[model samples]
Target: MAPYQFIERPTPFNSKGGSTLPIFAVTPAHIETGTIDPIALDWAKKAGYKAESGSLLLIPTEEGHLGGALFGLGTNPSEQPYITGKLARTLPAGDWHIETAPLTANRLSLGFGLGSYRFDRYKSEKSSAPTLMIPRDADGADIKRQLAGVFLARDLINTPTNDMGPNELEAAFRGLAAHYKAEINVVSGDDLRQNFPLVHTVGRASADAPRLLELRWGKKGHRKITLVGKGVCFDTGGLDIKPASSMLLMKKDMGGAANVMGLALMIMDAKLKVDLRVIIPVVENSISANAFRPGDIYRSRKGLTVQIDNTDAEGRLILADALAYADEDAPDLLIDMATLTGAARVALGPDLPPFFTDDVELAQDLTEASLETDDPLWRLPLYGGYEKDIRAKFADITNAPAGGMAGAITAALFLKRFVSNTTSWAHFDIYGWAPSERPHSPGGGEAQAIRALYHHIRQSVR
Candidate 1:
């Protein structure tokens, strides 16, 4: 069977296929105005569907067929931008179209498409999902491009570590470079030790081998945008092993790398006018005698000596090298994404990622973009006073702060030390996976903050 297709061909105004199911997005105030068809209104009233927030009421035809679905948007429709996304899963399987709604047709269409995503790579039987017909006035191209980037991230993160190790990530990285004619390079194995010693130290024990992947694109004179992602394909906590429960979701440790590439796809696809560079310290933090031990000291690519207070803190070590590499160029913007700390998740919960930046203008732009794009981010203070938290007694910095108080802030400070040249640098500590299903996001690997960053860049470049 053909895979689910999201964008449909342009149709006449208010056009819907015969098999297409209508979805009515209504608010409580609108419902009381006697606007809905009497039959649907009667069925809805009897079913206790008061059009409250997040409520769903299925309408039946006179012949008892699946006539349509009524989705509640509460008092304010904008507050429930993603409410219609639920329709992709809840309503019976068929083509779906929006009959009435306050949201832009494009946003609603994108929400529906995002909800249609399912990871069936290892499944024996794949279930069919309800498909959405792209609305006539909607920017189908933009929606498809964004959805493609998002699905790329979701697929990469959802794959088990067995199939998504460093080597496979390199292949995917290379594939993206080849698609856009980007300059790509990879330094792996012992070669990594010569320059990126920290990256090599953390990944040496894995069978797939450790590597630094680089991709550069766009014209040289354009504004330079550099992205560094922690590509710990599967983090097993190294010698300092995590408990079985903690290690269960290690496959998504590479979510930062996945998201970086996903955003790269959007930048290239949209032909955004900027020079882009993506650096990923792709590695697996696996256990073996060769694994870097806790308390070991290693020199980073940036020439700072680091002491591994805990082997589980390997992501920061690799990112230190990559961010240092990115900082050397002193691009217009430097952003690094990582699944850095559990403290971040505990502080902000799963939905909102915490970003650290001293540049006020950059922070303002990101805040506006986050609001505009619906990709939420919260700013966490760099707290220069906490600089001592990451200090190493014998080395330049400690990978793991001993007290673990303000772990997230200390981790951000640890990364900040490597970034001296770049003035507009921000670090995003993301959960990378949704703890549970949301209206527009599935349970597995979810892309965070990239859309907002993309919007910021798009505006900056123009």
Candidate 2:
């Protein structure tokens, strides 16, 4: 097996070992009070720097070389904690350190590291971005671990389907498992069809065989935390093909898997005390003569027959089999993530992914962690009211329900059916792609919900 080109190299934070310029993050209040360096303040005044949030201004030395810089925090600086991230793009290529900032050292450093990401694997001219020296008070190792996980997910998601299909995804999975020295088992072909029927059905159309990939790590006696991600490498919506516009970004259909892989990296790197299991049902929902069609019914691994009301609803079918298989383990926590519904995007937009879980403590902890880590997550109800919608006339359940109301909820509910054995289970319907650039994230395959989950898990282990 030759080295897969798509498995990205780890992009870590820079150490504070060399010459670095200072960056002072100033606010309008600071300028008004004249608390900043007088020379720099006067220069900012001459430059008409308004201290607008996310704005940057570079100072010059009398010798005409790079000097200190100013970053604007605006009035309510705390409103956007990752505001310093923009500096990674705007700063000249050199080592830099924060002299003063409204945000904590951890946030400022983390933001810069995240903004420094570049997915230029295919480009002839690779990106060259400035680096920030890790703050002495910040957890540099933890930040590096987080960035490594995020970069892994982003790279996997950003890769085109030609380089990231089921086979490639399996290779990446195997690579990650090998890196961590974890135990991995993959089921495909006849075994997958016989045992995980729904996963096989949704994926049968692709040239590459569909696979159920599982990775187990950590000591057996630790708390069991099992994660399942929908690995639809490419979704042409099966026989119910998507329009050209909808198909453009389908390479990111495996975002859920990417994210969990990243989160798993964080957990494994941190050496968190937990038994971790990752389940990825890998497939490419393509158009072929054998592609599962609308109205097709297939029995799942859990013995529940699923009626495919729409072939585009293939993610849930694969997840159904994976979740059922995971449920049998009765892990302390069971989580499934997927790019499952457009309705979630319509409801919450892209930045904030909606998570569904009935566990109160888990929701509260995740809410706290989201705020702490700045990983945006909103909890949507697993509303029992919509339970009747997924019921099918002939099969046990319909992969897609009619009247498209609360589609995200209905999808969560549909996945919930196979998860009865697990006491604590959560589902995240993630957009997984940043439509445009943001403070800490660029416009490409994004990692959603994992940071909060990582912090939540860390706290749980403690």
Best by lDDT: 2
Q: For model 2, which pairs clash? A: none
Q: Highest TM-score among the candidates is held by which one?
A: 2
| Per-residue lDDT of candidate 1, residues 146-224 (tens digit) | 8778877877788887788887888888878887789998999999988899889999999988999999999999999
Candidate 1 residue pairs in backbone clash: none
Off by over 4 Å in 1: 1-19
Output the worst ten-in-a-row residue range by lDDT, candidate 2: 1-10
TM accuracy, model 1 = 0.94
TM agreement with the true structure for every prediction: 0.94, 0.97
After superposition, candidate 2 runs with Cα above 4 Å error: 1-12, 16-18
> What local lDDT score does residue 148 receive in model 2, on the 0 to 100 scale?
87
Per-residue error at 27 for model 1, in Å? 1.7
